[model samples]
Target: MNHSSDLISGAATAATGTQTTSPEPPPRRRLSRPERERSIVEGAVKFFAEVGFDGDTRELTRRLNVTQSLLFKYFPNKASLVERVYQEVYVGRWNSYWEEIVADRRTSLQERLVRLYTDYAKTALTWDWVRLFMFSGLRGEAINQRYLGFLRSRILEPVAIELRAELGLPGPDRVPLNIQEIELVWGINARIFYFGQRRWIFNVPLESSVEELVQLTIEHFIAGANVLVPRIVQAQIDAAPAHAD
Candidate 1:
């Protein structure tokens, strides 16, 4: 009978003599033009979200397991790739229905606002969305500027107009939104936005659920607006220079 030590020595000798090779990985499938571009865009969104606009293309290509030349074939440059990421992440997530929700006067202003913010949180409060936006702002990238302009024009301004209507104040066409009025609206938006910041950036755990907080925020805004907006409009009217009758 072979001893255990003798059997182990024989197995070791056999293993050393026979070189084992790993099985070859399956071949990568060639992507169609659209598929390839889409893959690059999707990968770039995650990459920039992780490392920001300062992240280099070489690293991005490495992360994507694609050649730099292939990346350029689709995007031509890093700026173009960043732009595509902005479009995909920022613009793509925007809902046209948000505009409708803000403009829907059939619903009470408080209800509409709560609904809109609740919907907005679904897209805007995520890790990718919040992180990418903060990174872009830190880098002083144009993404923040562009998106803010869009927000002011589309959402904030419209909400201000609706607030005016709710308070029986003249529409913006009659008396354009004063800076105070705009900033008041912005205050509410800022409060909601900070909830995301505390969550994603500062890594703070919020006790209240997003829905609960949003409803609370909207309620507070409506309560304040009901009191303050009239005074704001009245002050604007008072401050206006009297024209000769």
Candidate 2:
């Protein structure tokens, strides 16, 4: 036989004799129940943000190297898992200090507003927060409504009261806010909220840091409020029907 044929015959004889095989990959290290559960939750945060609440968990489990039973053991159901996500992303993330700092009487309203927005933007303008917020809004989720109501009661109403004070107008309790004035505060808030969307969602590059953005927003709002609030107040006053003809 030729050298090549002899070599092949020798290899076949060796294969037949030993039945050569490749080693299997090492098994994954086992995680404790708590560690595994926490791992799943964190993974869910990223997964849900990417694919939204409607996205399948099957792929999530596959990526997590876990069985569906294991995920369900910790979360019970997909809805319960989503509730935990809401708790972590929204309910738990809220800083009551935002309302407290804005309500602090020592600082000028402009200073207070700037501080509040700057502090808020630091946490609230992030990818997880912004994307989850947009996702909830698009899904018609109740958490978003609850968050809006909280803002209306806590941040916006307080800011509105301060704006009235700035203009020497009566307090909301004493003079009640018109829809227009309430929406003016909403407009300011919407601008800041949308600024995050522009930066994070639309991939707009902002030259300003969060602090600068907050300051710029406050400056424009204060200047515009100084000019327009007076006019708005006057319009309300002028439109008030004269004493019974």
Candidate 3:
């Protein structure tokens, strides 16, 4: 009856009757570029969800019913495809929201950052590909670099700049943001959002529906950040993400 329960019901329905991976390929045979990409990406998510970033490409392609060479032509090599998948497929449509928020100027900085993270949490629960993104973050450097790009550009820089102006942050907020702190906060909210998405089947408790959770989370951050004297009000910046604590 609650939002999480409703989301759980809807996701369960949407996940049914649809084959996640394409049919297997021919024995000892290669595949076309598009087919290889399709097979590898689709199968890769399964591997990512289970085995993570270092998941075997051989097994991945084979499951797609294609030869390794077929997969190679499309990806060139295994490591490279990991980068592509992280950026292109794993993040996918999520990046569009990224560009808009980072560039949009119609909302306050506080609104922008909260909107960004809340939207992120909501999408994580709903987007099937997010499983791959979440799992991949644990692998190592290749994934770490991808993570860094996201933090620096999408998360940190925007927050650093906007927080400075919005809160008139006078201390460390002006200097370069700390990576460790950024990663910590990023992980915390990500964990919460992910739990909300899975809705207890994964064994994590959900406190609210995805939509309500996002709204409450946004408000919490705004209230916490507004403690700075005379919260700077900018009505032109697009709503997105941030935090120091």
lDDT of candidate 2 over 1-245, digit per residue (tens)? 47999899889988889665799999988888888888988899888888777779899899888899989999889889988888887778889999998789897888998999988887788888888888888887776888788889888878877888878986766456777777877876788888789887899977778788788889888888778776777777777777886
Model 1 scores a C-alpha lDDT of: 0.89
lDDT string, candidate 1, 24-125, tens digits: 999989999999999899888888877888999999999999999988999888888888889998899999999999999998989999999999999998
Candidate order (lDDT): 1, 2, 3
Superior candidate under TM-score, 1 versus 3: 1
lDDT, candidate 3, 1-245, per-residue tens: 46999997778878885546888876875656676576677676566656667678887876777788867877898777776766655456455665478456588865675667666665555444555555655554355456657656766555555555556654343344444434434543565556644752365656666656666665665565555222322311222245578
Q: Give lDDT per model, in order.
A: 0.89, 0.83, 0.59
> Hey, what RMSD does candidate 1 come out at?
3.6
The number of the candidate with the highest TM-score is 1
TM-score of 1: 0.88
Residue 166, model 1: lDDT of 82
Candidate 2 Cα misplacement greater than 4 A, ranges:
1-34, 230-245
Rank by TM-score, highest first: 1, 2, 3
TM-score of each: 0.88, 0.79, 0.60
